[model samples]
Target: MHPAALAGATLGRLAHHAVSGLVGAALLRGASKAAPKAKPATRKAVVGGLAGGIVAARWLGSAAEEARLKAGDMLAEARSSLGEEAPPPSAVDIGGHDHDHEH
Candidate 1:
């Protein structure tokens, strides 16, 4: 897709992985107290956490992608609406400023 989509996807995946790793590690450690071995419940918690994190991240990424696309479209529309002549930037003279201009 577009660069926005790619960037969103990449960032989302990274964030998802980081969060999932932290959560998973915490869960595993917490569960270790009850059962040192990897049990069904522990597995469930890890898998569930990972799945949830990924899904949420993907949704956020999609939303960001949509927003980017909308912003781009709006900018294009604004440019077209402005026609050939675009607005000029607002600036100050700054010629008589207090700064030392001698050199």
Candidate 2:
């Protein structure tokens, strides 16, 4: 996979995690106010959920980085097997840019 594509995927995952965390927090906060007797449990749930979100995001980011490194290693091996005379891989625009024509 291309470096740009890997970067795009990582950024997309980070964005997803951020949005989910915010939504989770908001939901928990709202739920907390609905029941006065379970206030302690609500607080615990909110804290746990926020912490879990952080851990999950970090894990996902690390996984993506690992996958990117593995892909690069595989690509390098393939290129070496093909020898230096082989043509380069085609350009891929993972950033959503239009590259049909030269600038």
Candidate 3:
């Protein structure tokens, strides 16, 4: 791989790791503070719920993505039926913001 690509990959991995670690640490700290004397069963149940939630999120994300893709297809077909084509990339307004702002 090119040095630039390697550096980019390394930076991406480091950023991901740093963010995940910070989030996980914050979650644990909050939970500990909220339940300093949690029962073993309660802890086990919380962990199980978190694990199931993570698994469910993956499937949910896939379903949401599939739905969005189908919606896009339908939209494209509808526009084509109406003898319309999408605006060019440069003509599309994103966030309704003008690009010619002066500092």
Candidate 4:
């Protein structure tokens, strides 16, 4: 990937993480204020939710990465089958247009 695009993707992920954290903190604060006596339970719930989210994210992320690799492999296989000098997905045009129409 181009450096700029890679940087943008990295920054995007960082932004998402930062926002998620801020939102989580706000939720915990609200929960604590909403139920003064149930602070312990609220804390427990928040912790559980955060843990569950982390687990789910990891599972889903791995699954997605695997899928992407499989897809790339399939693409390369198909191109070779077609006697192609076809470029990899990343090497395709960045103009948001389908290059498959020619193939």
Q: lDDT score, residue 94, model 3?
A: 63
**Model 1 spans with C-alpha error above 4 angstroms:** 1-33, 36-38, 85-103
Q: Between which residue pairs do clashes occur in model 4? A: none
RMSD of 2: 18.0
The Cα RMSD in angstroms, rounded to one decimal, for candidate 4 relative to the true structure is: 17.2
> What TM-score do all the candidates reach, one by one?
0.47, 0.49, 0.45, 0.49
Tell me the lDDT of candidate 4: 0.89
* Number of the predicted model whose lDDT against the real structure is largest: 4
* Residue pairs whose backbone atoms clash in candidate 1: none
Q: What would the per-residue lDDT of candidate 1 be over residues 6-101, giving only the tens digit for each residue?
A: 999999999999999999999978877778565777789999999999999999999999998787677767887878433333342557667867
Clashes of each: 0, 0, 0, 0
lDDT of each: 0.83, 0.85, 0.87, 0.89
C-alpha displacement of 91 in model 2, angstroms?
14
What candidate 4 gets wrong by more than 4 Å, as runs, is 1-34, 86-103
What C-alpha lDDT, on a 0 to 100 scale, does residue 86 get in candidate 4?
58
Residue 22 error, candidate 4, Å: 27
> How much lDDT does candidate 3 score?
0.87
Candidate 4 per-residue lDDT, tens place, 5-99, comes to 99999999999999999999999888767898887887899999999999999999999999998998888889899999658567766676666
